[model samples]
Target: MKAEEMWKASTGKGVKVAVVDTGVNPDTPSLKGQVLTDEVPKEVSYKATEDYDGHGTSMAELIAGTGADGTLRGLAPDAKIVPYRVALTGLDKAEMQKAPHLAKVIRAIADSDVKIINMSFGGKIDLPDVREAMKYAHDKGKLMFAGTGNDAMETEFTGFPAAYPYVVGVAASDESGVVGEFSQHGNYVDLAAPGLDVPTWCDKTFRSYCTGEGTSMASAIASASAALVWSAHPDWTANQVLASLIDTAGRDWARDDPSTYLGYGLIRPRKVLENKDFNPGPADTDPLAKENFRGVVDESGKPVAASPSPSTEPSKGTETSDGDDQGDRASATASETDTSGNTTLWVALGAAAAALVIGGGAFAVIRSRRGA
Candidate 1:
């Protein structure tokens, strides 16, 4: 992804990303001054800074961690993080009850100044309230990203929020730009990012960083990729930012005919950040209008209302590369539901590396060479 060169162009300054997950620990060495805890809405701020599972903190760091003292460096290191703690799986029953409702949390972030929303969790069930909240956030012009899921080899269930209209469903990929075998595939998959073999927090203990793999990291990296573009082009609207990403994404198939596994292929923000003369088309036009409208259905299998007309002249000059073949697109409904459970964080922990304490045990750090 030419991250070092991309950083030379834009370090994601002046951008704030909202990480909706288990929770985030702001005291981590790399996140010392990168988190804006006070900016989180009080109504949904329960334990926002207290990471019960270390998953949310890892997502935050993936987006904006400073990489201080050899800690994991984020794709957009200069960006700020606004943390929101909601009850995802792995939390105890008591903490789950105390955590804010996912719908309420989404609504609150929709009303905030955050530019992007990164949801690194997924659930088999689809909640109506959360769907409405996603629509609200879309209407408010907030860019949102969620994991397509990591259960492709199993049930291959369509994850909620990711399947919801207006939310960009991201899939996990590797350094070769090949979609991870575990990444769930469907029409909802909008983009792919490096998710396999990434470094992340081991657990709530924050004792050491471990090799992690999942769509959760992909979503965070996708969010950071947007931050880099948004920071470089601060005036671009959410639609414009999204359009730029779609336009510049690496792909083998035609833009209109997306792949089930890789969607628009791997995210390449450096393509946008490095181009000063790039035109992001119309700010009010949605890049994913076709998928947001035609690809989704109602509870009774009726097609949803169509979005406004897309840009008559879509952005030209997309970067293409070798990728998997295209497949049939699927439709989702706002009223879809399952009796399963709440959203689950998508990270799968791997072996921990030797830990190194920085600054008198302020936090422990671990190193990895894998690209996010």
Candidate 2:
């Protein structure tokens, strides 16, 4: 998104986005003036803006980076970032040994005043505390967005935070508008965004930048997109904004039968923002009523979520690797087949390790220090 476009309309100027991930270093040139640490609750406020792993910082940059020193430019540069550090990936060995304490961090965010929450992390397990906090934030009118996880070709399971109802689940697609091979899919995916070879913070050290791929990047873009919409229509409640996004999301499938792979299709903020005459329908009506997932009630007051019967099976996808003449490798185990109909792609490796190998190959070998 361009600054000129934002200036002409709304560029997330007044919106405060809560980046709930590893941590964000305030010293980064692009985020020098955009991070807010004082507002975080005192209990979990330590390292609120100190990004130990670069992933959180990169997400922040994608959401509100000012593009200093030709760094990564955020989708909503004018927005403010409220860093809410969690212990998803960058904790020390000692911290990991103590049994990951993610619940406390989520609880703190639920009590904050930020209106938009961006979660770029998730795992297979659905932590009870985390789900409860999501409900709290939703009831508080805060728009929450999360990555659908990135283990697409391997584990077909969608990530947490995204699985929760009322949360906007984001997947990844390339510049030409094809979904990435690694973006986890299912009924959870609500929107897609750009998440390939994009610039990102190198690490918590705040020393340099690198290019990487993951659903996390896509989630950040989705968050930034929400910030743009919210910035333009500040008076609209969270429900209204989310409803508009779903209603306007780009999709060719039946409005009621969302695809398991693409979900609601790619997100085109340009379409929604360019048309000022667009009406988002009713605020209370959920556009995804007919899709999988059951308790979700639609305009007709019918259940929209999948039932808990034997017929309801988990979705799975198969990824094919190029250069190697081999049969498609179905993720260890999952439900449903992902045939994009016409789109074929190469497979991607796992996250963290791949981020280091593919992105920091030379840097890691020469610097003798791997990113946390």
Highest TM-score: which candidate? 1
Candidate with the greatest lDDT versus the true structure: 1
1-372 per-residue lDDT for model 2 (tens digits): 333454467668999998877677767767889998778877777667666667677778777877666555577779999887655543665644442255566566667768798877766565567666776777677888777766566555545667676677776666555566666666677776655666665555666655566667777777777788888887777877776766666665555555555556666555567778767677666554443346567899965543211112333322322211110111111223211101111111222211110111110000011111
TM-score of every candidate relative to the true structure: 0.81, 0.77
Error of 2 at 195 (Å): 1.2
Query: In model 1, where do residues sit more than 4 Å from their true spots?
Result: 295-372
lDDT of model number 2: 0.60
Weakest lDDT window of 10 consecutive positions for candidate 1: 358-367
Extract clashing residue pairs from model 1.
none
What alpha-carbon RMSD in Å does predicted model 2 have with respect to the real structure?
10.8
TM-score of 2: 0.77
Model 2 stretches astray by more than 4 angstroms: 1-7, 96-101, 288-372
Cα lDDT of all candidates, in order?
0.71, 0.60
Query: How displaced is residue 267 in candidate 1, in Å?
Result: 0.4
